[model samples]
Target: MASKVMMTPGEILREGELEKRSDSLLQLWKKKRGVLTDDRLRLFSGTSERAKELRFHSILKVDCVEHTRKYVYFTIVTTDYKEIDFRCTEESCWNAFITLALIEYQNRRAVEGFRRHRFQRVASEEQQEEPGEQRALSPW
Candidate 1:
């Protein structure tokens, strides 16, 4: 049976190793330790340095490119249209975890945005009402 991948709300999502395609003349595949958080995906190099970060707010979508018998290849498209390619073992479900975490982060952001907009609208409406306006009391 296939394993299920789930995201932790408002927390670090997942951490694992992923093979990323480099943007060099040779275009080599390098191993990276990926830490998926609620707000960003942080990648660390095999050595001592932290490599790259892909924030969820700037990430547009995750696209699955291909699935071979041994690995799953996917691409992450950023809001600025930067495409990052990644591959992982088939059983690791890296693609699924990334997709799910991205969606959850987006949904949370949408809800927070809606709340802010609604609050601002309500406040504006309240301010627009004449301060000295009188209202009849409801007969209880």
Candidate 2:
């Protein structure tokens, strides 16, 4: 588990309850608040214990986002198909925050993967070249 103090570097975009449908059987909604941060989304129950942590790297996509008169609703779908629902006051716009963070995370991952692949290809090519065949600086 990541320390909350260390999590400070991550911005907290929103803090509010995990919303439930009127017919849902789960009774714990009142105690759990969805916390949106730059690196992860967390569900915190009561205070000290973290119910769940969904890291940006593990997120496959945000399945849905909906709004009603009273609140904004969104669902985060993880790589493993775990769906987490959250809602906040209409003014918070938590859905946008989560979407932006996920986008940024995905972009960064893509760039890093590209860099690693390029480096490996260059290194392998250099190894395959004969010592005297290496390109030399132009004297002219």
Candidate 3:
């Protein structure tokens, strides 16, 4: 059994078996089951030493979330144009959790970007003006 590793910082929004579709010519349509985390999706073939990690930022989108009688299926499309399919039991709702986590991650990044831009702008404005001509800070 592979001992679990501690999560670095981000809260794990979801974790479970996400069977990844193999892209090798030999495996063709073969699926490899592995553990999925909010920050990265990893697959290990019988040993933790062989784990493969796919980070969330590298993922372009989660598409084709559908379900059959047995399982819910979805595809993760990476920025590099790689498509990895995953299937989980219907009750797991892996698709919904991944979508929500991706959205939240994007929102956090946008807010941080805006804050950085605003800080730079304010600093530049202050630098351009003389100390005596500095504008009063707004109460808001």
Which candidate leads the pack in TM-score?
A: 1
- CA lDDT of every candidate: 0.88, 0.72, 0.71
TM-score of each: 0.84, 0.71, 0.72
Q: What is the lDDT of candidate 2?
A: 0.72
Regions more than 4 Å wrong, model 3: 1-8, 26-38, 131-140
lDDT of 1 by residue, 1-140 (tens): 99956756547678889999999988899999988887888899887585688888899999999999999999999999999999999998999999988898899889999999999999988876644244334333
Model 1 has an lDDT value of 0.88
Poorest lDDT segment (10 consecutive residues) of candidate 2: 20-29
Clashes of 1: 0
Quick one: ranking by TM-score, best first? 1, 3, 2
Candidate 3 structure, TM-score to reference:
0.72
Candidate 3, residue 123: Cα displacement in angstroms equals: 1.1
- Candidate 1 regions off by >4 Å? 1-10, 131-140
